[model samples]
Each structure stands twice: as structure tokens, then as C-alpha cells.
Target chain A: MRLAILGIGPVCALGSGIQSLRTGLQGKVRPNIEEKIIPTSHGEKMLPVYQPVAEGLDRFIPKRALRRVDPFTQIALLSTYLAIEDAGIAFNDKSRVGVVFGSGYGPTRTTFKFLDNIIDDGDIGASPTHFANSVHNAPASQVSIFLGLTGPCSTITCFEHTLSNVLVTAWDWLNQDVVDYVLVGLGDEYCDVLGFAAVGMNAGRTKDMQPMNFNACTFLPGEGHITFLIAKDKSHQEGYAKISEIRMRRDLEEVKASISNDPVIINASGNLQQGKSFLKVQQKQLKSYSNLYGGFPTSSAFDLAVGCVSMKDRKIYPVPESQKKEVKLENSIICLEFCREDEFNIYKLE
Target chain B: MSLELDLKKLIIEELKIEDVEPEDIGDEDALFGEGLGLDSLDAVELVVILKKHYKIDLEDMEKARAAFASIKALAAYIRENSEVQ
Candidate 1:
């Protein structure tokens, strides 16, 4: 069974919704990176991080529902609601739908806040509300509760490849006839701790975040959420792109053998070492998307979203003007992502 | 804020009791089950609040249940057992 993307809701550093993302990809808007100071052992350090533009989520979700959820969970619910609305699908029976969400760092701020309460004022001072929302699956649970979906609900937290795993798992559920529709996506939030870690780990090499540049040592930390409503290929005619195939590889040879020299969108927003390795992939044509969304573990989700838009619009959002080249748009688009030192995911979108 | 008013505000804010104001919560109203409709999670949070703010720890399950029976009962328990001045 083939799975098709019926709707996409992307809340990223570029902007919220497809139009904002498309405009950002067209080089009409630059990424909004904010400089913030984070506390360190000796003093304070400043770092550049990509913060998502607020979309006034209160307008979509009721105040009662919003009070109990954290920022990450709020983003997930809003994105999912937007996707379902975008698909124009009505829920007659909520049990026929499922939710699968992924996150590189799940509810980091909430977890830390709970820990702070415990450490600062003992266990009795810890907020039970914060503790309830600190789990990795909190976003998924919130989505299911807010949307009243009773089908299969799960969450994956595998750092960079979380989105890939969520997509693959959702595909399996759809193929098995477990659910009629599945909302799969990723939601990660930016925290000062993450910023401090990113900067401290790559002190010398880190620079302003830019995509596809193998020579840059620094990547800007980013956080956002993107959700998609996916269903069987023949089930819906309004799909953006049909997911032809998905493959994961741990060995370089396996990735090389599976990859064809077709025009491909490369996710080159990883560390310098991974960027160097991605540079070796011989492709007839190549493009990078990290420039628009900034560098993050789940940044590939943005790339895939852009790929779907490009496919449907019959236009390719080019790389930076300095590295711009003629890209021949085709019916099929290949997305190559190197998520980790030993892990890579290849997606065939048509 | 007075102890009762403080408790009401804390309950409303911590438990995320929506569409309800601090003055709306009756002193003798049930905290769980029928009145405010708080669940077991809210009960646990109430315990934390009592201990953290009032320095009144109800270690015994029976006494804790009795104290949590109503907003008035919780306030009374805090008034009698509070270690904080």
C-alpha cells in the first residue's frame, strides 16, 4: 500500500503554514535568528538560536485546553488541528484516526522545571502539572486527547531520525489497515540548556547556521513542529506527493548503493564531519534546505515538507544565490538525510 | 491573601481550573468527585501545595483524604497543623 500526504502543517523558524514556508524557501525572507544569553559555569554566554514565529495559537485552541499543556504540546496540537483543517476531513468516527509524533528532545523545558522545583524546594515543591507533561509521549497524548482520536497513538524520540521513524511507523500502521488516517509529525522546543550544549560542544567550529555549506563549523540551534495527514495513495486524490519508498542505512556502502545519481534534495545541516561525508554523494543535481529552517535534529521534516510543496507546484526552491545552479524539476524527488555518524535515511517522493 | 483565598487561587492556577474564579470556589465545596471536578492528579498536586506553602504534611492516607474532602476542610487542617507562621 502506498501512502500519500494529504495535508501539511509546518510551524518552523521560517514561519507557520505552507505559504510562509514557501515564501521563506523562495529566498524572499531570511531566517529570524535571535541572540540570547545562557548561563554557564563561569559566567554567561550568548548564542544564536532560531525561534519560531508565534502564530497566536490561542485563537485555534480554547483557553481551557491551553492551560494544561506546555509550549511543545501546544504547538503539536495546533499543527495537527491545522493539518486536519487543511485536509478538509471531518471526523465522523474519531477511532478511525491515529496520531504519531516525534521529538529530538522531548519537553526539555518542562522536565528541567520539574527538576528545579524538586532541587530548589524539595520533592513536595515539585509541580505535579509539570511532571505530567515532561514525558516524551506527552505531545502525542495531548494530541490524542485534544483531537479525541482513539486509534493507535505513539511517540518516537530518536534524536535526528525521529521524524523518519515516525513516518515509517505510520506507514506500517496504514498498510496494516490499523487506521484509516494517521497524523505523523515532529515537535521539538528550544531551551537555554540545548543552546548552551550546542555552543559548548562545538566551540571553535560553530558559526552562524547555514545549510549545505560543508566548510562551516557552526550550526544554529532551532526548534519547531510540523505535522502531516497521510493516508493510502488511492484513498485521496488531493495528495501533495505519494511516498514511493523509505530506506534507512547504517553503513555508507549501503547508502551509496541505494542512492541513485538523480536530482536530490540533501539535508546537510548536521555537524561538520557529517557534512563532509554528505558532500561525497555524487548526484546529478543537489539542493539543501537547512538555510531556511536553520540547523536542528528534525530539520529534515522541513526539507520533506518543502519537497512536497515543490512537487505539487512544479518548482524547485533553489539554494543560496552564491551556490545557485539550474535545477531541473522532475516528477520524482529524492531526499537524502544524514542524521548521525552511522545513520542515514533516504526518502523517495513522487 | 488570606489563607483561604490563597488556597483557592492556588487551586485554580495550579490545577488549571478554567472558567472559574477564586471567588467562585465555595469554601465547603468538594475538591474532587462532584464539585470542582478535579481528578487524582489534581489531588496529588493539592497535597504538594499544602506541604509546600503551609508546611503541613499529611503523611497518613486517611487524614490526607479527610483534609482533601473539601476546600473548607483543607483550610481548617492547614490552620491547625501549619508550621509556617
Candidate 2:
């Protein structure tokens, strides 16, 4: 069965919604980076991170529903709601709509809070509410509860390629006829622990963060959510793109064997590791959308969203000062994501 | 604030009870089941709140269940066992 992306909702460092992202991408808006102080052996150092804009989130979800959920879950729920509204489909049978979400660091803030309570005041001081929201599946559970969706819900956390894995799972569910539509989202939240660790790991590397420069060693930490409403291709509703193929490979040779002359969108999010693998591909036509979304594990979700927009608008949003001046949109666009040394995933969008 | 009123506010805030106020909860209203719509999870949270705020540990399940029967019972139990009074 063929699957189509009915609607796209992206809440990123740039802003929320497709139009906001398009404007940011086209206008080459400067990234909103906030400085965080982290304690080190030599004293304190400042770490720059791309923080998402916090306005207009309350409009997407009810106030009562936001009380218990952490910010990670809130972004996922809001993006999912926006995608549902964008699709313009009201599910009378809520059970027919499944939710598949992906996250790199799930509820890190709540996890740290629980840890602090336990460490400071013993196990008795740990807050049950924080403990409840610290699990990896909490975001998916919140999506099901707030949306009243009784269908199959799953959360995938495989680091950089998490969203790609989620899309593959959703594709299988649609092919199996388990649900008529699937709401797939990818989200992550910035925390002190993650930011400090990132700084510690990249201490001696270049501190200047730039996603457009594939050779840059700096990977700016970022967090946000992006959700897509996908359904079978039989609907009369217009869609951004039709997903033709999804594949995950464990070996680099297999990925190279499967590559063709198709226009490819690479996931070089200013990370040295991802850039190293991205440099291996000799494809003449290449594009990267990480500058608009910043660099994170699940930032590939934003790359896919940009690809869909490129297909719909018949234009590609490239890096501001990259060597490539023009982007020719083909009938089918291939997305190549390099998660780590040996694992990669390829997506075909038409 | 009185311990009873303070307990009501704590319950309302910690449990994220929607559309309910501390003044709305009667002193003798049950805290579990049909009274406040609390469940096992809330029971655990209530135990933490008691230990954290009042320094009264209900290590015994029976004593905890009895104290959690109602807001009045909880306030009385805390007043008797806690050093706050």
C-alpha cells in the first residue's frame, strides 16, 4: 500500500508551522542561541544552545492537560494536534488513528529532577509525578491521552535515526491495515545534563557552531518536535508528498549499493561524525536542511519536513552561503540519514 | 494556613486536579475513589507529599490507608504524628 503525507507540523528552533519554517529558511534568519553556564574543573564555561520559541504553545493544548506533562511531552502533543488540524480530518473512531513518536533524550529534565530528589533527600523524597513522566514512552502516552486516541501507540529512541525508524514502523502499520491514519512525531528537549555533556565531549573542537558548513566540527545542541499525518493514498485530500520507499541499512556498502542519480538530501547537521559519512557519498546533487532546525539526534525529522515542503513548493532551501546556488527539485527526492558509524536509513519521497 | 486547608491546597496542586479549588473540598470528603477521583498513583504521590512536607512517614501500609481515607483523617493524623504542631 502507498502512503502519503497529508499534513506536516514542525515546532523547531526557528518557529512553529510550515509557513514559519519556510520564512526562516528563505529569509536566512539567525538562530536563537542561548548561553548556559556549566561548571568545569577550570571553573565555569558557557555553552550555546538553540532553544525553541515558547510562544503560542498554550493555544494548541488545553491548560488542564498541560499541568502534569513535562515540556518534552507538551511539544509532542502540540505538534500532533497541529498536524491533525492541518490534515482537516476528524476521527469519529479515535481508535483508528495510531500514534508513533520518537525521541533522543526523553524527559531528561524530569529524570534529572527525580534523580536530584533521590540524591538530596533519599528515595522517599523522589516525586511520583516526576518519576511518572521520566519514562521514554511518556510522550506517546500523553499524545494518546490528550488526543483520546485508543489506537496503537509506540515510541522509538534509536538516537539520530529515531524518526526514520518511526516512519518505517508507521509504514508497516499502514500496510497491515491496523489503522487508517498514523500520527508520527519526533521530539527532544534540551536539559543541563545534555548540554554540559555535549560541551565536555567537544571541548577541544571548534566552538563556532554552523550547520550550513558541512566541514564545521561544531554541532549546536537543539530540541523541538515535528509531527506528520500519514495515510493511505486513496484519499481525495491533497498531500505534500507520497512516500514511496523506506529502508534502513546496517552496513555502508549496502547504502552505497542502493544509491542512484536521484536528488539526495543529506543529514549533515554540523556533526563531525555525520559529516564524515556524508562526505563519502559522491552524489553530484546534494542538500542539507539542518541550518534551519539546528543539530540534534532527531533533527532528521525536520529534514524530512523540509523535503516535503521542497516537493510541494517545487524549490529547495539550501544553506545560506553554501557552494550550491540552485536546487533542482526532481519528481522523487531521496533522503539519506547517517546515524552513526555503521547504521543509516534512506527515505524516498515523491 | 491551617493544616487542613494547607493539605487541601497541596492535594489540588500536586495531583493537578482540574476545575477544583481547596475551598471546594469538604474536610470529610474522601480522597480516593468517587470523592476526588484519585487512584493508586495518587496514593503514592500523597505518601511522598506527607513525608516531604510533614516529615511523617507512613511506612506501614495499614496506617497509610487509614490516614488517606479522608482529608480530615489525614490532617488529624499529621497533627498527631508530625513535629510541625
Q: Pick by TM-score: which candidate is best?
A: 1
Clashes of each: 3, 0
lDDT: which candidate is best?
2
lDDT of 2: 0.80
TM-score of predicted structure 1, chain A = 0.93
lDDT at A336, model 1: 79
Any runs in candidate 1 off by more than 4 Å, and if so which?
A30-32, A54-56, A203-207, A250-261, A282-284, A320-328, B1-12, B17-40, B53-56, B60-85
- Tens digits of per-residue lDDT, candidate 1, B14-62, equal 7778899988889989888888888887777887777677776666888
State how far residue A101 of model 2 sits from its true place (Å).
Answer: 1.7
Stretches > 4 Å off in candidate 2: A28-30, A54-57, A203-208, A212-214, A250-262, A320-328, B1-43, B60-85
Compute DockQ for each candidate against the true complex: 0.54, 0.44
Pairs that collide, model 2: none
lDDT of 1 at B17: 80
User: Model 2 over residues B1-85: C-alpha lDDT tens digits?
Assistant: 8889999999998888888999889999888998987888788888888877888777798998999999999998998999974
In angstroms, give how far residue B7 of model 1 lies from its true place.
5.0
